[model samples]
Target: MKPVIRLATAFSILATGCAFGAEQHVVCPARLEPDAVQPNRPPSGWQLHMLRPVYLTEGGMLHGPPAESAFLVPDGGTSRKVGKQSGETQHWSFDVPHGYTKWMYCGYGGGGATLKLFRQVAEGATECTLSSQSADGVIKEVVEFVCK
Candidate 1:
């Protein structure tokens, strides 16, 4: 009787675990194509601009050792540096051509920090701003822009 009871309890626990696992699911966005062009100038009518800030913090305070460099890469293009600024933040702009709609802005930093921006702006929208942040490393903030 004792052996039978032990087996029954073990079986019930295993069944419950399996049922919970079966209900768990994860959803992810579709992959994008590799970047092909890194044009030196914007296409014709539109433009994309980006800003990145790098910093270090300690004990909830905004001061520490200088952070490693950060980079921004637009979809269908190569990585570009955010030019230096007076303080911790850096800024740069990219040229987007007329009729170009979709964009994926990626930010990378030393020490494995990363951030991403996935956005779709309206056709007549004159200006739009999108931003993202990473939890760790040099990339603290990423701000993107699309303007007519």
Candidate 2:
């Protein structure tokens, strides 16, 4: 079946519950536009990148070791760097796809500081929020961008 159909089916199943007498689980893999993919980056075409990697502890991430660099991608597919320590602010340009209504996020605890997001405008460009802190610190800001 086409990916969109498959995704819809999965959600339908999840929302209404199994049709049969037994419990069923539907897993739908994300579909990507092959031509839009870039090497060393994640697949695109997803409308929502939910619970996307935001922070990791000193051990790297929730699942493994320290990253060469820490970052999170929200707003459909725009990447924002999660710095190595708490309270660090890096400027991010809102290159998010149009039509997304709001961006939401929260950080992991490690640097004894909370992760914060900020917005600003510079030279007519929309400057999105930055992920603060942790060179050796690990955090994952659970972020979401919802469409209007």
Candidate 3:
């Protein structure tokens, strides 16, 4: 089945070319298979932390550890950076396919990982809001925004 990329929080799928009327829609979701991927650097074996890894066989991202955790916010969120303690960066880059609306992500932080979805833009790629959720379900932090 084609995975539906709902906001999981919001109700907008901009990739579908639909004017959201407070209802979420579906566009194709990216196939994020790690085993089928080639590394841009070396896999850190860390959770959800893709190294200068090649995403979707097109682009590659390199990360440097973040200082404080970040989150994807509403109404104007675009790319986000999550930091690690080992001077390593837990970066996220989306090379979404055409007709793809939402970018579905499932990640967990060791201490607590921040999750963000890049907001949309007219030119180039837009980013989503960043929300924080821990791996072990022990902690939950506030979801930050670009405005505040």
- Candidates' lDDT values, in order? 0.26, 0.27, 0.28
Candidate 3 lDDT by residue in tens digits, 8-49: 433234343223323222221132333322234443553333
Kindly list the per-residue Cα lDDT of model 1 for residues 69-132, writing each as its tens digit.
2233322322234443211222223344674442223322334323222222333333322323
Name the regions of candidate 1 deviating beyond 4 angstroms: 1-98, 102-104, 109-117, 128-137, 141-148
lDDT, candidate 2, 31-66, per-residue tens: 223322223333464442223322322211111111
Worst 10 residues of 1 by lDDT: 57-66
Model 2 collision count = 16
What's the TM-score of every candidate structure?
A: 0.22, 0.22, 0.22
Model 2: weakest 10-residue lDDT segment is 58-67
In Å, residue 127's CA in model 1 sits off its true spot by 3.4
Every model's Cα RMSD, please? 23.2, 17.1, 13.8
**Deviation in Å, model 1, residue 54 alpha carbon:** 15
